[model samples]
Target: MKLQTQVPLNKATNQIDYSSQLVVLGSCFANNIGDKLAYYKFRALQNPFGILFHPLAIENLISRAIQQKQYTEEEVFFLNERWQCYDAHSDLSSVRKEELLGSLNSGLLETKLWIAKASHVFITLGTAWTYQLKESGKEVANCHKVPQMVFKKQLLSIDRIVQGLKDMLHLIQAVNTKVKIVLTVSPVRHLKDGFVENQQSKAHLISAVHQIIKTGNATYFPSYELMMDELRDYRFYGNDLVHPNDLAVNYIWEKFKTVWISETSYKTMDEVAAIQKGLDHRPFSQESEKHKEFLKTLGNKITNLQKEYPFMKF
Candidate 1:
């Protein structure tokens, strides 16, 4: 007897293959999928501006990237000995002001180019709760550890979320009309926002995503539903009980593979998996003849795979 109900997933019409260019953006869950794609050696550019948790932050970055807008000194501020931009995650913050601006501009350029050639763009929204700068009245992507008193926290309305998503779609489509956009709500719980508030945030995101997909402008993947339904237990979460643990991520990834990955790519994925396993193998005796032979074989495998896809690096 089946113990749990599965989340119904339809096989995608435009499945991802080795030739497809992919752009993965948004929440840390996007990184989980992106990591899988990277392991299987797919052409994917993930979170060029780092992990953006909400739709408006994503929309802001995409808009600026499409316009090729450069970050200037005026947009960055010194905080805790590092220069930070309100528009990007702390991952892009730098010790030097000039370096931060350079990295921001470089990320924008990279994102612009990647979106232009992407065959599929995956966006995962994490929350509807955002913090607006008290002085500027601008919603900041990350607070960069700025004092809580300096920012006003608020929940975005469903209508505002929907409009932001639409704006993102318009901007992306303007640059790459044929690119398939896939949207998903992250399974990670924003418990810091309080349990009830977290639920409301996710509800807003889910509602807005469905509204967008109904117009046939994008596809929706029920990642959050899968976690909440099929894997309905605290064991699926990490030690913090906030993020999905590795087991949960792998489970969702297998589900994602069946629906979105092209069958033709399976053989190559297996080959890559073998190579990856070999690379991760730790020999007891490095000087042993057997280990030398194993290393040689691994090198040959890498060389052969690189011959087919020059972009892959060990």
Candidate 2:
């Protein structure tokens, strides 16, 4: 089936001026847009705990918003309250507790909350391919410890993706009928998927996103197009091309700011880029021969952790 290519917001026959409370969901791409909206001074909420992975997380978050969806009356809990194990020597126990009993879902839930509050919701659909569990058949968190044999790779179809957006639209409208929707695909390549599979997979996502925008009124930002087209030159990519380098994110962000937000938003994303510069920049941290020993220790810890949580899903 044919789909209309989404023009840059500036080129659209009907331009939109939207400033509303925001939430970001879906994939890592939302991280950039969410940061921009916050920089633009829109009331924006990033996923409180961290990025979540599925519909249950989103549903649980909204349920919490409407009521106290906590496991018990205390309301002081972690990601999983059912587990009574505690660690006396761990400083991360508190964080682990919160994650166990808390309401943090996928990053997309952040987008959902933003949709409920904002006049317009911008969604960034990442890869169509998802790693889901075999036993429960649910999508696991990050595919951490999932047995490769037990886990399966799946790609959502155009119809299903469209239906999900429509459903989300209806759900958000139920809470606030005035919310508008903007959709875009993520441009980062998945080295995991062979090149051909990756392109066809992304095309499937772009098709659905494009088809939904064809009805008019709603907007579709060309984040994916800008990245794939304008930023795909070999020089734009990093050593490992799976994730966009900071330069690439900035290039795409500049194009996106002109189309969606403002020059100020562009600057804010730039700040993020600046901060990322020193993430792996520590003097003598890795240069010393100590790194080899450190890696061995780290590997052993990983091995032990895996043994303890073999069924753990990332």
Candidate 3:
């Protein structure tokens, strides 16, 4: 008898192989999946401007990138000895103003280039809650630890989220018509918003995503459902009990692989995994003949894989 309920998933029509170029965006969970893809040496560009959580923030970045908008000094502010842009994550903040502007503008260009040729774009929506800067009357991707009183916190309405997502789809499709957009709600709980409030935030995201996917312009992956149902236990959570632990991430990734990754790539993936494990192996004796032989074998594996996929680097 089945003890746990599983979220049923169907294989995607356009599966991802090594040849596919991917762009992964939105939320820290996006990084979890993106990191997995990267570890396996797939061609993936992830969160160029950094981890953005809400739909409106994501839309703002995509809109600017597609338009080739440049960030100016007036757009960035100095705070706590670091320059910051409300439109991007704190990870992009820099000690120098010019450095911050340069990074932001370059990120826009990189995003445009990747999105234009990406075979698959995975967008993971983290929350519907957003903070609007009172001075500019605009939503900010990250607050960068600015005084809480300066911003107004708001929960984006389902209608507003739907419109933002639609705008994103329109913007991306304008550049690359054949790109397949896959949307998923991040399973990481935003408990800092309060438990009930977090549920409300997730609800709004889920509703808006479903509304958009019904049009067949995109597809939804049940990542949130998988975490909540299939791996519904505290053991699957990190110490904070908010984010999925490595095991949970791996479990979700396996499910994702089954549905989204091409079966033909499996043998190659296994070979890559073996090489990765070999690379990570630490020999007890550094100068031993056995260790030397192991290193030689590892080097040959890397060379062979690189010959096949020149883009792959150890």
Candidate 4:
């Protein structure tokens, strides 16, 4: 008897190969999958503005990037001796306003270029819940430790989420028509919103994603279903009990590979994995002949791989 239910994922019509340039956005889970892509040395740009959990934040960023709109002083504010942009994650915040502006503009330009050429775009929506700045009456991607009283907490309606996703796809397709968009509700639970509320938030996100898929604009990856049904045990959870642990992430990634990644790339992925492992190996005797030999072998392996994949970097 089968102990667990499996998500039936059909092979994608358009598979990801070395030639494919990937752009990943939205949520911490997006980073998790993007990290796997990076590990295999795939050409991927992930979350340039950092983890955006909700659809509106993602929509806002995409609009700004495609429009080539530059961020100004009004969009950024000085807080706790540091400058912060409500549109960006705290990861992009800096002590110097000029540095922050430079980073944001550069990232926006890079993201615009990435979207223009991306073969596949993966979006992982984390929650339906969002916070809007009360003063500006605008939704904030991240509060950046701003006082709670300054924002109005709310859950996005299903209609709004669907509309935001449609806008995101329209903006992307305007720049690149051939891009295949994949949408997934992040398996990571936002329990801080309260357990029941978290479930409601996830339900809303899942519903919105399906609506997008039904319209033939995107495909759905059953990441949330896989986590909930296949890896139902607590062992799949991280120490925080909200995020998936490394093993769980790997499991989901393996499933992703079977469906999305091209089978022809497996051999190259093996070579890349071997090189990664060799590079990560710690030598006890750096001056020893064996260590030197190992280094030479590793160098040769990298050289061979780079010859085949000139874009690959060690």
lDDT tens digits, residues 159-222, model 3?
9999999999999999999999999999999999999999999999999999999999999999
Decoy 1 TM-score against native: 0.99
Candidate 2 vs candidate 3, TM-score winner:
3
**Cα RMSDs, all models:** 0.8, 13.3, 0.8, 0.7
Model 2 residue runs over 4 Å out of place are 1-19, 39-41, 52-99, 103-114, 262-314
Q: How well is each residue in 30-49 modelled by candidate 4, as lDDT tens digits?
A: 99999999999999999999
Q: Taking the tens digit of each residue's C-alpha lDDT, what string does model 1 give over 183-210?
A: 9999999999999999999999999999
Q: What TM-score would each prediction reach against the true structure?
A: 0.99, 0.64, 0.98, 0.99
lDDT of 3: 0.95
User: What is the RMSD, in Å, between candidate 4 and the native fold over all Cα?
Assistant: 0.7
Model 4 lowest lDDT segment of ten? 1-10
Model 3: how far residue 47 lies from native, Å = 0.4
* Candidate 2 per-residue lDDT over residues 1-314, each given as its tens digit: 73433334573332223334555655566776666555433456654434433333333344444343334324332333232211111121244544544333232354445556675555666676766667667554354333588778787788876776666556666777776666777777766778888897788878877777886635777777776756646676778866677787776766665665544334444433343443334656776777667666555644554464343211
TM-score of 3: 0.98
* TM-score attained by model 4: 0.99
